[model samples]
Target: MNKPDPIPARLAALKTTPTPDLKQQWRDLFDSEPPPFNRRYLESRLAYRIQELAYGGLKPETIRRLERLGEELDGGDRSKRSVRLDRDRPITGTRLLREWQGVEQIVTVTADGFEWQGRPYKSLSAIARAITGTRWNGWVFFGLKNHRGRT
Candidate 1:
């Protein structure tokens, strides 16, 4: 097989990167709390950061286009990749996991909703809140959205 694209491969690696490592990176980059999102979210944002430093990020036209498609992006050409509206959201049976205080928490996507600890929940926010004891936007909590523009 042909060699994988280095950027995408690095992006994918973000999924399994250690939480403490990512957390330290977060501290170095943002100087704030690392949002309680899952690994995939962290990887995507970090990959964007890496790419922004290497190749220029999204074009302004792309950002405007994505805005029209109901997604917001940083107007600045930083940390964004190509935006494709046709892309599908994470599908059924996708397993999202995060490590919290030395315990691993898992959530699985289902057709109607999400499953956590063997029970069906209406939203990931519910699960996030249950996990952190604070109300959270599940999408952000799980890194379905980025902490900044164009991520």
Candidate 2:
């Protein structure tokens, strides 16, 4: 089998040929100066812009990247501001209930009641009972009042 000729030699020969200056005949049309480029600042700005775009959306991958960017901006520590920016961003196919009693502990919502950890609970009290294995403080997880209107 014969080896192919090197392409670099042909490219080098082409480099010796003079090329016409395309911009030589063109004059400045506008007096405005070109924008200054700061690579680090531009990268940080872009990261933040992407993060803002992902906020309050259902894109999990973008949200995760935004969290990482937040952590980076916070010097690798996630502050309350960063957390609040990324928190409660809902995922698709999941309904969010606001201010509903025992919503957090409710694993699955049914027509009658809610289920937690695969156990049948008639109410939040029943779920608490099954979870804590005790009668007292059963309403703690639900954040509800037992009988005295105290959580």
Candidate 3:
């Protein structure tokens, strides 16, 4: 006879598990302290860990391919790799929209830089400054950067 599947139930429990208990599970599973991320992040990472333990993780070749792709994206610069690995950078061809003062602002991500108001910009802060007529962190202005742990 075949055994019952527990991975589905384990994954489901993550949705309802309390934060403290989830952190305990993280300690047990990862053998390390849980990251200082939000509950959603904890739940998602815990769910992935549960499945990975029950089944398996990516193959070596797949991981190598991903590393190669990262190197290609960042030109093998370790410092830049952190940014790419964080998945914070928007992909090319993305359209970021913001509304301010009853007007809609649009910025298009291009291969080289960003396009706002039919003009090329080197960084989001520049665009944000143009939009607000004041200095501002572009990522925060665009609602992309999370101000976690900031007073």
Candidate 4:
């Protein structure tokens, strides 16, 4: 008789496994302490580890390809990897609404920039400056990003 695969059973069991047991499994499989993450994280990582050991991990070529893609996205700067440019801009045709000093303001996103007050603006900061007569981060003014630049 042919041997049945255990990976499916192992993965399913992870959903119900206790957190302490999952940590122990992590220690056994990874030979290190589990991260201080939640139980769901532990379970997910443990499941991946189980399948990785059973069916092998990513191929060397695949890893190299992923690294190359990362380098292209970050311009070879590892620190820049955490910053994603695509997310900085709102989708084209999106309309953003805000109020400043009790006055309603509306801005429409474009393919390359934004339009506000019946005027085309290359940047949100410029629109904010025109509206408030002072410098302001357009993203913050538009509420697309927080003061810390996070979306």
Task: Give the winner by TM-score.
Answer: 3
Clashing pairs in 3: none
Per-candidate TM-score against the hidden true structure = 0.46, 0.26, 0.56, 0.53
* Model 3 per-residue lDDT at 21: 98
Which sections of candidate 4 miss by over 4 Å? 82-151
lDDT of 2 by residue, 1-151 (tens): 9876554453343333322211111112122321121222223333343344444334799889988997777776644443221223223322212122322333454555555666554555566566556674433333333244432
What's the C-alpha lDDT at position 139 in model 1? 68
Between prediction 2 and prediction 3, the one with superior lDDT is 3
Of the candidates numbered 1 and 3, which has the greater lDDT value?
A: 3
lDDT of 1 by residue, 1-151 (tens): 9976587776666677787788777676567877767655566677778788668878999988877665345555544545421244457998887766667688898999899999999888899999999998776666666656222
lDDT of candidates 1 onward, in order: 0.72, 0.40, 0.80, 0.80
- Between the candidate structures 1 and 2, which one is better when assessed by TM-score? 1
In angstroms, give how far residue 61 of model 4 lies from its true place: 1.6
Single out the weakest 10-residue window by summed lDDT for candidate 3: 80-89
- Please list all clashing residue pairs in model 1, or write none if there are none: 74-150
Cα lDDT tens digits, model 4, 1-151, are 9899989998999987866788899999999987654565578788888889998999999999999999988799897656443366777898877656756688899998999978899999999899899998777777666545665
Candidate 1's error at 96, in angstroms? 0.7
Q: Which regions of candidate 3 deviate over 4 angstroms?
A: 84-151
Model 3 C-alpha RMSD vs. true structure (Å) is 8.2
